[model samples]
Target: MSARLGPGRTARTVIGVVIGGLFAIPIIAMVEFTLRDGDGHSLAHWAALFDPENARQYAPIWLGLGNSLVLAVVAIGIVLLLLAPTMILITLRFPRLRRAFEFVVLLPISIPAIVLVVGLAPIYLVIGRTFGTGIWSLAFAYGITVLPYAYRAIQGSIDATDVRTLAEAARSLGAGWGAVLTRVLAPNLRPGLLAAALISVAVVLGEFTIASLLGRQNLQTALVVVSKQDTYAAIIVSLLALVFAFVLLVVIRLAGRTQGSAPRTARRAATAPSARAESPSDPSDPSRKGNNT
Candidate 1:
């Protein structure tokens, strides 16, 4: 078995190394640029970002970062609140509408960002007139952009489980629609909900076109502004953003894995004693003979 597996393992190792190196190259370059200052290595640019005195100078970046963070939270909330219930309702009550719902969710993907921006401009103007152009309003558009991804993640989870039966069962037990959704369906779809939230947050963080065109400052726009003012600082910020996104993805994956494993662990714990009970007693064991006696 070892001999047979050797070549495959070696190939996989080599492939992994190559892929990691490929991803590392740009990051390595960014780090080197950020560290280089006047022929010597320094963290002055990075330090400038956090310097209290420099906060006034970096107002745009600070404001942009703050806006992005707020937008991410709002976007995630909107995505889950909008998609989760709609998806569940469709799955449970309007099964025939699934195809149409999916088509609508996916329509955003085919629409070009520039075109979408143009289409949304008039509505945004009306919104700005009504709500006064708070950057958080961008979350509505971001929510739309992330809708397809969120829908697919939740839909996949719904499809994998018997949501219809669960809802029906909950209803049969005198549970209201609200209770059935919150108490029964939500717990089962935790991983999918988490995945959707993470995906939406990531999308909002990295988004530029909508925020930029809509006259909003977000992380990506802030990075662009910082780039013009201080290239090294921008590079550091970009690298940090990349690292944060990677870490978020890793966390989502780990959470999903843990959620998936819990049931299996419980099943094993429940079955082990039963399996032992069903097994034939060993005649050679004095303890077994005594128990029988």
Candidate 2:
């Protein structure tokens, strides 16, 4: 068996390496350029990113990072909190309504982010004039903007679970709908939520046109502004942001794995005891005689 599989496995490994190299080449070039000097062997560009005058010029770096993270986190939270329950409710209680809701929710994906920003700019202006350009307003926009990704993630998770069975089991135990959702449905959705949050964060972090058009001085917009003055430092700042995003992704994956594993362990524990209790005793047991008699 090992001999027969060798050729196929070797081919797959080769293909995987080729694909990985293709993706890595650009990233390698970017890092090299950012770290390289004009003559090709220095870290001067990276060094300049830390200079006092440079630091003042790049003050937007920390602020933009914070703004981006805040936007991503808040958008993800709102999307999860709003979408999870809505998806569960629709799938459980009003499944037929999903078609209509999906059509509407998906409209944002088809609409260019720039167009959406253009349309929403007036509304945000009105809101800012009244309530100020607060975090909540931006979060709300980000949440709506992210619906295409978040909704699909949530909907896919709901599709994976035995929603009807879980709901019925919970109801049989005298649990309310709230209890059923909180206990039975939400716990099983950690992976999907993490996936959605990651995608949403990626979208919001890289978003340029919307922030530019809306006149929001968020990270991407700030990055553009910095790039105009210091091309090399801008590249370095972007590389740092990319590193931060990678770390965040790794953390999310680890958390998802830990959370995903716990329930399966508990399920096995519950099932093992029940299975042992339900096993047949000796055939000579008196319970058999009761039926015969």
Candidate 3:
């Protein structure tokens, strides 16, 4: 068996390396491009980004980065606090409505960003007045844009999990809705929820047309604006953004895998006592038999 698996494992590892190289090559090229400086390569472009004199020129990028981060947080909030619960409720309570709800949730992805913005133009007029044009208000639009992606992630997880059974079991154990959600449902759904959140963040950060058309600043818009001026600086920022996203995804995966372990441990501990109590112990052993007598 080990011999059979050895070849398969090596094949898989080789495939993985090839795929990783395919992705890493472009990023490596981008890094090399930014390092170019006429006669020689150097970190001058990167270093200039932090230099005091050039600070104001990069201000828009900073502002846009901050806005994008805020939008990511708010968009994740919308997905978790609103979209996720609606999906869970549909799964557990309103199975019949699932198809219609899915259609509504997924409609945005089919529509182009420009068309969505055209439709949103009027609505944002009201929103602008009501919300005073804060960058965070973009979350409302972002929430819609990210819904399709987030929904797929969360729904996949929900489908894999027997959420109905878990909910019912928790309720039978006298857990309230809040308790059940926090203690039972949340732990099980953590993987899907984290994946959905990460997807939403990725979508928000990469977004350009919608933010550009909406006259809002975001990371992509800032990159475009910076690119026209200090091209190398723009590339550096793009490379850093890519690296940051990669790291963020790695950390989130690690967190999703490692978290909720304590609850599993506690559950095991709780069940162990019951198992020992229910089982008859060592009746065949001579010491046990003598003690009983």
In terms of TM-score, the best-performing candidate is 1
Off by over 4 Å in 3: 1-26, 248-293
Compose the digit string of candidate 3's lDDT tens values, residues 48-119: 898889989998899999999999999999999899888888998999998778678767755777788898
Candidate 2's C-alpha runs over 4 A off are: 1-24, 38-40, 50-54, 243-293
Off by over 4 Å in 1: 1-15, 261-293
Candidate 2 — what's its lDDT?
A: 0.67
lDDT (Cα, tens digit) per residue for candidate 2, span 155-183? 54555567788889989999998888778
Q: What is the C-alpha lDDT of each candidate?
A: 0.74, 0.67, 0.75
lDDT of 1 at 70: 97
Clashing pairs for model 1 are: none
- Best-matching candidate per lDDT: 3
Residue 267 alpha-carbon offset, candidate 3, angstroms: 22
Q: What TM-score, computed on C-alpha atoms, does each candidate reach?
A: 0.83, 0.74, 0.77
Q: What order do you get sorting by TM-score, best first?
A: 1, 3, 2
243-270 per-residue lDDT for model 1 (tens digits) = 8877776766665565653443222212
Candidate 3 Cα lDDT to native: 0.75
Superposed Cα deviation of residue 164, candidate 3 (Å): 1.2
- For every model in order, what is the number of clashing pairs? 0, 0, 0
